[model samples]
Target: MMSINFEQLKERSLVIRKRYHELERIHHESEWTVEEDALAFLTDAGLVGRHVMSQQGRWPKENTEEELKHKIGESIWWLTILAERMDINIGEATESFLTKTEKLFEK
Candidate 1:
């Protein structure tokens, strides 16, 4: 099986944000309040969820694994963009969440 590294993926988020910022109609990080960016990120995440359901045949629209993969990647990009605008360290936040969840279920 191919191994995936979250740290490497996290680093690419910055590059994605930079490229996306260059696209027309995309807002600069400075132009948005964290709340606004957070909302936008949430919207993208919801679309990703819909795509996932569609891939499972639980939602409407003719979806394929490719579509699902694209949506997931797009959602991650939005997430990183929001994090950047908010001055957040995505890697640290991810680690914190993992640690918190692991401790929560510790017996």
Candidate 2:
């Protein structure tokens, strides 16, 4: 895989999302609503939590490390899509969050 910066990743994600939307329209005669996208994100986020529980031996079924890793990445992809749909800049939001959290822990 090629190395990509955040901007490039966001662009690629948008392209992929557009293609998915097109496919959805062709198959179902409508693309997913923003609320549907958000629900999808939530579903994936829940899977991430389940994987973490598996890692900690708290889940009934064991999950592989690779499964957990991929789920985490997928959750991030969902977040980027959600931010784009909501007209938010995910990069800026993440930066602001990190900066604010760091300031709170400063000596």
Candidate 3:
């Protein structure tokens, strides 16, 4: 069985958040509102990123680094919210994931 490090998971999450902040620094003009804004933001990012992927062209819309950073942080926010909503901890989630993965590996 492979070992999962809880600290490493948290660190990766923080790294992603840090990158998001870096992006925000580069794209600071953007003003964002949350929740309803998340869907629109993802749609725009996906669309632009997809266009860039498909046609090798730039997106017409401008998304700031801060907005990008917020998106990444938002994921962590959602995850934390889920943990709180379900009354679970990061450790519990880690254990559950480990158990499920191990069960699959045993098959």
Give the per-residue Cα lDDT of candidate 3 at 36.
35
Q: Is candidate 2 or candidate 3 better by TM-score?
A: 2
Better of 2 and 3 by lDDT: 2
Clashing pairs in 1: none
User: Mind giving the per-residue lDDT tens digits that candidate 3 earns over 8-102?
Assistant: 65556556645665776678844333443355545655644444443433444443445555555555554543344355677688689999999
Number of backbone clashes in candidate 3: 5
My TM-score estimates for the predictions, one after another, are 0.70, 0.89, 0.35
Tens-digit lDDT string for candidate 1 (1-107): 57556556667776765565566235543545567667877887888888888888898779467877877877777776676667777778889999999999996
Q: What is the TM-score ranking, best to worst?
A: 2, 1, 3
Question: Model 2, poorest ten-residue lDDT window?
Answer: 1-10
Best by TM-score: 2
Q: Supply every candidate's count of residue pairs whose N, Cα or C atoms clash at under 3 angstroms.
A: 0, 0, 5
lDDT of 3: 0.55
Q: What is the C-alpha lDDT profile of model 2 across 1-107, one tens digit per residue? A: 67666687689889999999999999999999999998998998898899899899998776457898998888888889999989899889999999999999996
Candidate 2, residue 25: Cα displacement in angstroms equals: 0.8
Best of the two (1, 3) by TM-score: 1
| lDDT of every model, 2 decimals | 0.72, 0.89, 0.55
